[model samples]
Target: SIASPWPLLGPGQSTQLIFGPSMDAAKLEEARMLLNGMDYSSQDEDGDTILHIYTAKGLRECAFAAAEKLRDLGRLDAKEHKGKTALLVAVTANQPEIVQDLLSLGADINACDVKGQTALHLAAHYGFPGVLQAILSGRPNVNLEARNFEGMTPLHCAAISHSVTTKALSATGLTDVHLQAKANEKLSCVQMLLNAGASLLSQEIKSNKTLLHLAVKEGNIDLVRYLLRIPLPNVKDFVNMKAHGHTALHMAAGLHGNPYQEEILQLLLSRGADPSIRNLENDQPAHLLQSGHQGEQVRLAARCTPPRGLSCVGKTQCIIYPATRIPAK
Candidate 1:
């Protein structure tokens, strides 16, 4: 048989060797020849072509083989109906080598689909470190702050949560590249970035609240503690009672969270934060504490304060504010 028997593949299936799929694979050059004779833009009834099928299958040789040949003809830039290029297809399949080959051919590493996220973005989000390494080896800024349709960064998606990412990134001496805000949300990266010298006082896009506000919202005790070590860059509205009419204190004293409530209050107090500042509803931090269990009052807590403390948690709960908005928000 001049040509081997085709495998009985369904739509979008590329190879069909009667033998085992991996074992029956042909030399990369065979695919190169097939590529030289065909058009990649052609989509069959299944809406996929030879290039799409091979890359999507992660067929190591087949993807690079066809891409190498078509690239020589300068037509590898062909786009599919869904606007996915061959490189995008390869990435979707997690084929790193194919991605590298495509990138070498000038495939846009930053080429985004309709969603405005680069292949590197997707690679990072899915934790494909191998592919991401290949992508960043070309010097993609790990700190480019690239966002998807949802305004999240590749950093936000990679590693674990903000704290883990911060510790990992800090250990790498790449802490200088951490981001404080993504889509206007204060994050663990905020303090890491600040400690590495990011502006501690910067505000988010839609919200005027500082990073402290975000930290409090996440219930991240560590992040909240980290931000408090710096000066509290007060948000204008919070002081004027024009915005939410609640300070970071009001935010920190939220219903379900209490991480770093102690240290946060101290930082605020050291910064001259008044425990007496009331919210729009005329409620104070002590008022928020009232919702807690018996003896959870500020007076008891004040009494518990080290020697020479004259107040009690009850006295402080509804009267005086210890003063911190659990921040890193």
Candidate 2:
């Protein structure tokens, strides 16, 4: 028989067990034995159960084992003080393997926290592609469009998220590698959500901004380029989508000092964004261009004449023009 690492306690003597970073296989086995002897449904001061504590500590083996027992008891979806289940904790912690394990064990994929954020929302908002993928794969009836307290969907959260890598590097300073990786991860999250039938056109209730509006406003040039390239039936309509009467072009043009402002303005024009469309302030994109040489360049790009067979219809409407077709001086 395997010797127990724990000492024999007297009839009424109880001792606390301390798990440390150096815990080994024997310690884990002893811990498992200890856990098996206790009530799995127990809750702590914050209402965190054994599963929540193990999951938060990143104890995958112990957490999943507890999850299995909790599932058997029909308490897997149990919430703690903040109404977060073990599954939600896994995603928030970016533990993809644990997330997959919980999902396989029948955790609630759609359970929301007190803030109304589901696993999908947390994964997307934090740029955890692995966690997002795990949730997508395991979800039976996942709500892709579920809105959070901010009235933003998972896609909305993804659109505005700076990548985890970028955030980490901000304090140590940034590198091209960091920026490119951030762009790729952000784009990957957006693409996955879109492929799973998440709507590109769903606007957040607060500002009525679509994913396109959010991407451009974030000055994410790569994301903006990728978004515009998607083959929607009415690409022009999508390009000119309004948020509070301001089209994406209006937002880009109004980015007075953003480094990517000129490039984004040019890209929008190349993609048939209607610069003539006015915002609630009745300002066309060109009217919002900053003052100076670079702004003049952006203004020139927007003011390029319509192609041979198309014409500006009115002060508020115009035929689309690709920037490549601008007439030579």
Candidate 3:
């Protein structure tokens, strides 16, 4: 019997196959044979083609097969209603093998969807170092500094990941790459981006906060120490750098109850974080410390000298300035 060239999947059938429970190889092969000669360019009301549906559902082999077929038919980069390409969808779904196939089939690695995020951006956010490296290798022109709507680079996404798997580094033959167990997975991602020359000082679009600021706010003491030892050309300037009137020091001290905030604060201070630097509200980092630990306060005081007229206050807070209009009436 001759199989019909067109799959002609109804909306319900397509939804079931795309988003329903996993189908075995026999079912998948049946669907693939039916759609073997069908035009995959047709879009549903949502503007998602068969390829988009497969990628979104994270059907690995199905997505790869659909992507290659679509590529041969000149519809590889078809956008869903939201402007996300199959590559972007695959990355978001964390389908690394599908991502590999898409890249090999010549999907646009640098294509930013509606959110202005490229495949690399999504890979970084999802902590898929393997996917990131795959995209990077397939497209030598891939921009490491690509920014999304939030003005966040791949490096920023990596730094903010809950965890990053470094297994890819070893599998990809990156033995010399430093992977610190103390800092865990997210730290590995950050390290990979750093090794790739991602700028650590790049600020977030909205908050103007640097990657170091985010790491400190996360209360990752190991990440904080790693960032401090990055060895910049102008190390002192980098340490004293402020973003939106806040420094890493301020972020560490203001983290209401983070157990590591105090240790992070000391690390920042030892690296020359100026306690006198105030935010837009003119609150010094010392003022942000919730605890009145005399030992900690004395440690901070020793690192920072008061401004010309300002004097260090008790352990509660420092940087005392006269409230009166004149020194003497």
Candidate 4:
């Protein structure tokens, strides 16, 4: 017989169940047997409960059992050392089924981890559209606008997520297929948040950058196209909205070597992005164009299609701001 992982304790001493990094059939049986006797509320040295361990280790059966027990004990939202609840862990680990189960069992949807990231924030940041859909479907009152430590909402997190950026950075012929799929997933999450009434214009606290600014900075053309297609009453203003004295056009224009910069610049210009709008450095989008053949192409593109209330002159493109009053620099 295999020796029990739990040690026998003498009278007046209690034995704590020791769990291995991975669970096998025997360990699963042992966990099932110990479930009733184990204290659902107790935390180990790392402040992780049996449920946390099971969820983190991807023990689906053990996690389900532990989560049910935790739910019955009204401790479903119990946090570990970093304040990550099981739901948060499930989302971070990409366990969509477990996330749905936890939500159905009443996990706190708006609970934030130590970094102030909620389950929604994690799902968005990690580009788990399935998990995000589950969270949105399970909870009606989810804080769509909930801000993390950086004051970024789930929409903001999805806009410039690390997953999206990674795909953008390492893109190639074979990876392009995967990148397109991942981009679709990110777009799904963004669309779900928008359908659920998340604010497209909400700016992060640190840089005051909106979703457009982030998408443009990352050279995410899909997101840029999708965002521009939305019917906003102030579409031009949305395109021209400034962050730190720089608009999305400025960011796209200054993307000197980015392969997607020219296409993105064209999209913004077609959407009424004013190239004449200057940043804090007093450089217009046309002025910021990279020098060379590529820069000349971008400059011609800008000059050919000036924004409303602006016109092109001989050789040099000058702007005549409308009497409606131009925005302060």
Stretches > 4 Å off in candidate 4: 1-34, 162-170, 174-179, 303-329
Candidate 2's displacement at residue 255, Å, is 0.9
lDDT of 1: 0.51
Candidate that beats the other on lDDT, 1 or 4, i.e. the better one: 4
Candidate ordering by TM-score (highest first): 2, 4, 3, 1
lDDT of 3 by residue, 197-265 (tens): 678778888888788887787776656778887777877667767878888877876776655665676
Would you estimate the TM-scores of all the predictions?
A: 0.52, 0.79, 0.70, 0.78
The list of candidate 2 runs beyond 4 A from truth reads 1-33, 163-183, 301-329
Q: Which ten residues in a row have the lowest lDDT in candidate 1?
A: 1-10
Which stretches of candidate 1 lie above 4 Å from their native place?
Answer: 1-26, 44-49, 73-82, 140-143, 157-252, 255-290, 294-329
Clashes of each: 20, 0, 2, 0
Q: Candidate 2 or 3, higher lDDT?
A: 2
Model 4, position 145, has a per-residue lDDT of 91
Estimate, for each residue in 1-329, the C-alpha lDDT of model 4 and write its tens digit: 21112222234431112111233567657667779787767889988898898888777668877887888888888888899999899999887767766776778989999999999899988888767866876366899999999889999999887436545645664356766566567667788788778998899989989999998988777678788888999999988999999999889978887767867877887788876778898877666668788776665554443345543332322222222223433
